[model samples]
Target chain A: MIAPVRVGQAVRLAEWAPGAPIELSEIPANSAKEFILPASETIGRYDRDGARFTMRETTPEGPRTVLLGVRPCEAAGLAIVDAVFNWDSRDEFYDARRAATTVVATACAQADADCFCTSVGGAPGATRGADVMLRLADGGRQFIVESLSARGEELLRSAHGVTEGEAAADPLADVPVRFSHERVTGWLAGQFDSPRWQEFSLACLGCAACAYLCPTCHCFDIQDESTRTAGVRYRNWDACGLGLFTQHTSGHNPRADQMARWRQRVMHKFSYYPEKFGMLACTGCGRCARMCPAGMAISDTCRAIDAEESSPG
Target chain B: MSIAEARDEAPGVRTFRLTFTDEPARARFFGQYRVGMFGLYGLPGEGESTFCVASPPTRTEYIECTFRRAGRVTTALQDRGVGESITFRGPYGNSFPVDAWRGRNVLFVAGGIALPPVRSVIWNILDRRPEFGDVTIVYGARAVADLVYKHELADWQQRGDVRLVTTVDPGGETADWKGQVGFVPAVLEQAAPSAGNCVAVVCGPPVMIKFTLPVLSKLGFAAGDIYTTLENRMKCGLGKCGRCNVGSAYVCKDGPVFTLEQLHRLPSGDM
Candidate 1:
């Protein structure tokens, strides 16, 4: 099973052995995006012979795997990216990985200040993207397993447990709704030129940590790495916060400043993504807030936008 | 694809005439190719750079791409020999609706490096000349040296079927310069091609476009009749990399081509 475990000071998803200690107090620092859209992957490779070259596409052989202890938000992230990768022309690389993987989400039994799953139409025990759900029961000694899909039922059949009994799961985490996603999205529709974006992004150092840690920030950059005669075209994770994310070769930048970049980050998730994908890009996972070096929080920004929207002008 | 011919357009800018190695692929590409569609041209080690397929699909023997030597990929591309291979992923994005503009005069307003995209449409109309009305090209560059497709510009000038008004920016003209000298917007306004029964295609730097749109509007060109292509930075060119979106529209999928009316609907600040 691939579950979250402590490595030095951070919790990351790694192969788990039976009876190994698992970190369940907090979500993994790295989201489940790594399992599907890897940080760097070769999309194509080419070989050159003087002036002529031959190219071949690198097909992804997606191995069967299970996400053992991911949270609902983490599981939902894969589904959000699924819409984009499959839209219009299907990205076979992402599709292959997504099809072969099964999600086993554990319902949150505790909530921290950095968690806000309830605000974005997700909840502690939501089964939106999970194939199987594991709820804690009997004071963390037992799990009330619930199969949500055919994959979940198949997964349960491979388990060692023989007992067929029902048990009441522990109380789910008490996460308060920080802001209305609808209100924030609606307010953002009319606030593209608002000075508040500059205010919200003043402390931002243009570091893309928020995007890297985010489960659903799926922007990527494609480049070639090679050694003269041969090369591999690779797609790597990229973010809107970076200065060069939208810069043209002619030195013109559409989103010229950090304020515009910050606004894009927010508007893409809240308004544009929803208008296109029919779902918010954000899952209300507070990893961006939790990991930001400048102490910026998307939730706080949304809250402030909502406050402004609710106030008299 | 192999580079069949390479020509220097201006300093730091070049044009490559590429031919597909596979005959079936060539047939398939031309089958789907349209004016205003772009391609991703690349070298094995330098990655891909996006640009318009400069030559029109009407000329199916070869595809031509003009690019300024900027960034790694284009630099490597310009350095390659004539017979060298380059990867091409192409004919992507929405195209100029030339079929819809049949029997209407076509006015092309282009500035500097942006002439390539408009050139495709011009050739498309010229190739099907009987289907279209009068053709007028108002092409401008920052300087006489900066003008691309000098040979093609001379050809358009000689052709009685096409009315071509070439211009360089003020103070950029040479001693032998016969063309007008002014900014593109001012030149376009001065040229004053009849907007009635005409479809205007404009492509240029953002500053040129911003000022030119107003001139186009004042020339009795309706928002719907005026078209321009967006030059948003993109990767993948398949709408998945997520960088090329302006508001909800994926420039790779929804358009690299859009009408002035459509551009007005999008967030102008983002563009």
Candidate 2:
């Protein structure tokens, strides 16, 4: 089983042994994005012979696998990015990996301070992107596994377990909604030039940790790494918060400062993405808030925007 | 694609006329090609850079692209000689509505380094000259040395059917310069082409566009009659890379070409 297991001080997705420890209480520091859009991947290769060159296209071969015991928010994150990769020009690389993998989401039984799934149209047991749902039952001793898709039923038929019984599931995690996403999005649409952006993003360090650990942040950069004779074109992960993300070759940047960059991050997920793609780009995984060294949280920002929306001039 | 011919336009800008080695690919490219549509030019060791297809679809034998040696890819593209191979990945994005402008007058306003995009539209209209009405081109540059497509500028100047007014900024003209000596906005107001039955295509730097739009408006041109292209920084060009967006608009997909009326709906601060 591929599940979230502790690696040093952080939790990440790894191969799970029969007796290996898995973290069910907290979401992983790294998300399922690594399994789909990896940090770096080769898209094409070329060989040059003096003035002549031959091009070679690379086809991704995705193996069949099952993601076991991921949180619902992590599972929902995949659905958000799925819309982007398949919008108009389908990304064959992302499509191949996504099509091969089956998602098995575990309903959250505990909520942490960083978790805010309820605020963003997701719940602890949401079945948005999961093929199978596993709810903890019998005081964590057992899980009530239910198939949500045909792939889930196929997985269950091939598994080693042979039990046919029913049990009442435990109470779901209590995650309070911190802010109204509708209010925040409405506020963001009119606040592109608001001074609140500067105040809200004052502590941002521009480290891009939020984007890196985010489940739905899918921006990428393409580059060629090679010697004089041969080279491979690679697609690597890129973040908008990085200073070079929007910098022109002529040395002009549209989103120049951290304030603008921070505003872009929030606006892209809440305002712009929703207007274009019909869904928010965030799944409320809360990894960005948890991993930020500067203690900045997108939920806090949203709450502030919501408060401002209710405030009278 | 192989570079058939290369020409140096400005100090750092160069143009490459490319012919496809694969016959079917060339056929496919021209079949879908249009003016204002862009392409990604690249070398094996250097990544691809996005730029407009400078040549028009009317000249179907070969396509041309003009670029400045600003970044690594453009530098590498300029370093390659004739007969050298490079990768091209476009004719992507929306294009100008030249077909819609048939039987109507067309005025083109362009500034330094921005002429390549407008040049495609100018040549497109000229190739089918009988279908369109009167044509006027107002082009300007910071200095005479910064002007791109100098040969084409001279060709338009000599054409009896085309009215070409070229300009250089004050103090930018040389001793032998014959063009008007003023800024693009000022020169455009002086030319004062009639707004009736006329559609204007404008492309320039932000400051140039900022001042020129008001001049066009004052000259009785409606917001919808003026078209311009947005030059947002892009990577994938397929809309998934997520950097080429202004507000909710993906410049690579929805634009490169937009009317002034459409631009008014978007947040100006984001631009």
Residue-level lDDT of model 2, residues A180-219, one tens digit each, is 9999999988888898999999999999999999999999
* Per-residue lDDT of A291 in model 2: 94
List candidate 1 stretches off by more than 4 Å: none
Model 1, B1-271: lDDT tens digits are 8889999999998999999989999999999998999988887777888999999989999999998998888888888978888889988999999999998999999999999999999989999999999999999999999999999999999999999999999999999999999999999999999998999999999999999999998999999999999988989899899899899899998899999999887889988
Per-residue lDDT of B1-271 in model 2, one digit per residue for the tens? 8999999999999999999988899999999998999988888878899999998999999999998999888998899999888989988899999999999999999999999999999999999999999999999999999989888889999999999999999999999999999999999999999999999999998899999999999999999999999888888889889888888888998998999999998877667
**Using Cα atoms with residue i matched to residue i, what is each candidate's TM-score against the true structure?**
0.98, 0.98
| All candidates: DockQ | 0.80, 0.79
Candidate 2 ranges beyond 4 A from true positions: none
True contacts kept of each: 0.82, 0.76
Q: What is the C-alpha RMSD of each candidate to the true structure, in Å?
A: 1.3, 1.2
Q: Which numbered prediction scores highest in DockQ against the true structure?
A: 1
